[model samples]
Target: MSSTKDIDALIEMMAKLPGLGPRSARRAVLHMIKKRALLMIPLSDTLQNVAATARECLNCGNIGTSDVCDICTSHKRANGEICVVEDVADLWAMERSGVFKGRYHVLGGTLSALDAVGPEELRIPKLMTRIADEHITEVILALNATIDGQTTAHYIAGELETRGVAVTSLAQGVPIGGELDYLDDGTISAALKARKAL
Candidate 1:
């Protein structure tokens, strides 16, 4: 058996994580090994705990350790407005800016006909229900500016308009094909503040 088999396996697994290459993964594993007590052990325990308890929020599709995420359960977030995002990362990005006071709705992905994805595949139906049940007055479409994202936003806007809810989208600060997770806090705030009706 290879002497470094376990370490190599760990690097391989880490390499599969987003934005990590094999070389970066190896460096990360080596760093963790050098700081085993301070970083590796605690990281392992935390990862295991999160893997065991993490789940999608039943109400808004955010990931959390419970069936419903903290944001969805917070009464203070019930401001009759919902910011719709393509992923949980985007939702977290918006929250980090601390500009929006309303709640969020995470659409797992955009409508992609080429990829065979449709509204039914995402959380659109649930959003419709939330609009009615929560008496939502406005829905802010914070989707990315990609083709699929824009298509999904338009579809959602049309749907909400018929329900008498005002729909708006982030301004042109977001470059085409740029994702929310990549934008800085100031840019997110600017886009949101200058949002236009859809």
Candidate 2:
């Protein structure tokens, strides 16, 4: 039994992390202690470095270790198109797919009436500003297929309707590997409605 108040405090803080509880935090702390040379020291140094340097890009809301993110500053990504996503996770997912070759605008979150989240709360104003500033020609709504997501998309479309920009959305359907038997009624209906010639 170590009398290290600092270690206990660290465990408490780690326990507060998303998806990590007290038990997992304790186990992780113990494992980190055991692998101090291999993991703990490096992790501490990296966390400190990131804490000191991590910042949101001024142009976009993407998190990076600089004033501007790599994507925003890259000339190759200036394709006159902007893909709009709700969160950074969605941006990362689009990046992982390697399908899009344009700039991105993160909305922070969807417009939620229940939660009282509005356009101002997100980066909507910034997005609108970026449209003219970046000389964007098209705005792709890559939001999730939820009710709030569609509402937000429609609101954005309406805003951009007169801005001389083409607005489009991802095709709605069952997922690539989704089984028809396992799909919900809404999924089935959407897939049927969005069906095209194969």
The most accurate candidate by lDDT is 2
Residue range 121-166, candidate 1, lDDT tens digits: 9989999999999889999999997888989999998887779988
- TM-score for each prediction? 0.86, 0.93
Q: Which sections of candidate 1 miss by over 4 Å?
A: 1-3, 174-198
Q: lDDT tens string, model 2, 28-130?
A: 9999999999999999999999999999888888889899999999999999999999988899999999999999998999999899999999899999999
Model 1 clashing residue pairs (backbone): none
